[model samples]
Target: MMARPPLPLWLQDNLTLRLQDGLLSLPTSSNNSDDKNSSLTTTYNLISKRHVISSLVIPLLRHMRLKKEMSMRSKQNA
Candidate 1:
C-alpha cells in the first residue's frame, strides 16, 4: 500500500486561512477601495488585521476549542 503524502504546514495553514477568508471576500469586494482619498487604510490597521484575525486566527481557535471540548466530553463519558 502506498502511503499518502502529508500536506506541508504552510499549505495547510494557507488553505485553512483561505477557507475562512473566502467567507468574507464577497462582502468586502463590493465596497473595495482603490480611490485616491481612501482613509480606511491610511488611518488604521483594521483592514488587514480583520482578514487575518477572522480568516486565520479565529477559525483555528474555534477548531482547537471544539476539539478540546469533544475530547474532554469523550473522556468524561468513558
Candidate 2:
C-alpha cells in the first residue's frame, strides 16, 4: 500500500496544545447581576472536580500503606 506524506511535527503538536488549553473555562460577566449566578456555577463545577479526584486518590493511598505495613509485620514474624 502507498503511504501518504506525514504532516509536520510542529503542526501536530500545535493542534494538541490548542485542544488541551481550550477547556470549560468559567464564563466571565461584565455586570454585577449576572456575575453571581455564573460565579456560583463555576465554583460548584471546580469543587466537584476536586472532590472526585481526591476521593479516588485517598483510598488508593490507604490501601497501599496498609499492604506495606502487613508485609513488614510478616517479615518481622518470620
Candidate 3:
C-alpha cells in the first residue's frame, strides 16, 4: 500500500494552534443591526465542521502525546 503524504506544515500547525487556543462555543455573528436583532430572536446554529474536528482532533493529539511520552520513557529505561 502506498504511504499517505504528510500533512502540510501549516495545516498541522493550525490544528495544533487551535487545540491550544480552545474551540469556539458561541455562534459567530455580525454587528449589523439586522443580524443582531435576528440573533436575539433566533437560536444560534453550531458550526458542525469546526466543532466535530475539534472534538476528534483534541483527543487524538492527546493520545499521540501520551504515546510519544511512553516511548521516550521506555527508551530511557532500556
lDDT of model 3, residue 49: 46
Estimate candidate 2's alpha-carbon lDDT, on a 0 to 1 scale: 0.61
TM-score of each: 0.47, 0.45, 0.42
- lDDT string, candidate 2, 1-78, tens digits: 999877446545644554465422444545666455777766766775565446544655776799999999999999
**Candidates' C-alpha lDDT:** 0.63, 0.61, 0.63
Q: Supply every candidate's count of residue pairs whose N, Cα or C atoms clash at under 3 angstroms.
A: 0, 0, 0
lDDT of 3 at 53: 64
67: Cα error in model 3, Å = 0.4
Clashing pairs in 1: none
Candidate number with the higher lDDT (1 or 2): 1
Per-residue lDDT tens digits for candidate 3, residues 1-78, read: 999988657557766765575443445556677565666433434444456467666766887799999999999999
Off by over 4 Å in 1: 1-12, 15-45
Best by TM-score: 1
RMSD of each: 9.2, 13.3, 9.8
What is candidate 1's lDDT per residue for 1-78, written digit by digit as tens?
999987658658776666675533433222545665446444334555576677667777888799999999999999
